[model samples]
Target: MLRLSKKTDYALMAMKHLALHGDRGASSAREIAEQYDIPAELMAKVLQRLVRRGLLLSHQGTRGGYQLARPATLMSVADVIQAVDGPLTVTACSTDDHACDQYTKCSVRDPLWRIKDRILTALAACTLAEIVDDTSVPTIPVTLSRRTPAPVTER
Candidate 1:
């Protein structure tokens, strides 16, 4: 199954936290980690990676921490995922041509490529701002419909 790495998850959470508290000024990695119950060391590393990727700005010394390098609305989910986990790949052969042994004989390669592209487009369309803002919406109610089973007849 396709899934995002834990690092990516942490990165997204951190970004959302920063965006929410942006007006309060920068936040330390420890503060974010503590608020979310994440490991401080791991959060620190994640924040550092984001800074290196140019998605976050780091401030040093007392009362200093990290902040978003750009507006959250300008940053997509794909950007955070990519920054933490590199490129997104649905299949082994999606990235490198030699990644799969059946590279030369793969019949579904084109279809897989198209699927990957669509998935990326969807991810790119969603921004951190949209996600953070969505928190205020009421949860949709889910209703399950019950269906009666058909009687089995002997042939």
Candidate 2:
């Protein structure tokens, strides 16, 4: 199934929180965790990973915590997910050959690879700034209608 891991979800949440706050300087992981009802320790781990990935800047002293390493406009959802999850791969064969035994004779591999590429491309095209900017965010193109189709008139 196509899905983001929990760590990636938390990382995005954390980044969004920072983006919304802007240059309020650093914020404690505890504060972010509490605000979002996320586990503080898990958030710390996710934040540390982000720091290592250079997406986040962390400070250790008193009045210290974490902040965005760059403006939200410069970051993409793919970057955040990659920072936490290492890479966005929908299939084992695409990410690591050892993870799947059917890497060689899989007839469906090519189509699955294309689907993964499309998903990654869409994710890469979306920036944190685009998400933070309410008016610019794209809406999901889905519609639910309850009306029955009108009966055809006899000619």
TM match of model 2 to true structure: 0.83
The clash number for model 1 is 0
For residue 129, model 1's alpha carbon misses the true position, in angstroms, by 0.4
User: Tens digits of per-residue lDDT for model 2 on 42-144?
Assistant: 9999999999999999988888999999989889999999999877776667644645667666888889888888888888888998878868977667586
The runs of at least 3 residues in candidate 2 whose Cα sits more than 4 Å from the true structure, single-residue gaps closed, are 95-101, 140-155
Which candidate wins on lDDT? 1
Per-residue C-alpha lDDT of model 1 across residues 1-155, encoded as one tens digit per residue? 88998989999999999999999999999999999999999999999999999999999999899999999989998899999999878777865567687888989888988888887888888888987898643344557569767889999
Candidate 2 accuracy as lDDT: 0.88
Question: Could you list the CA RMSD of all candidates, in the order they appear?
Answer: 5.7, 6.6
The regions of model 1 sitting more than 4 angstroms off are 135-155
Q: Supply candidate 2's per-residue lDDT for 35.
A: 98
The whole-model lDDT of each prediction reads 0.90, 0.88
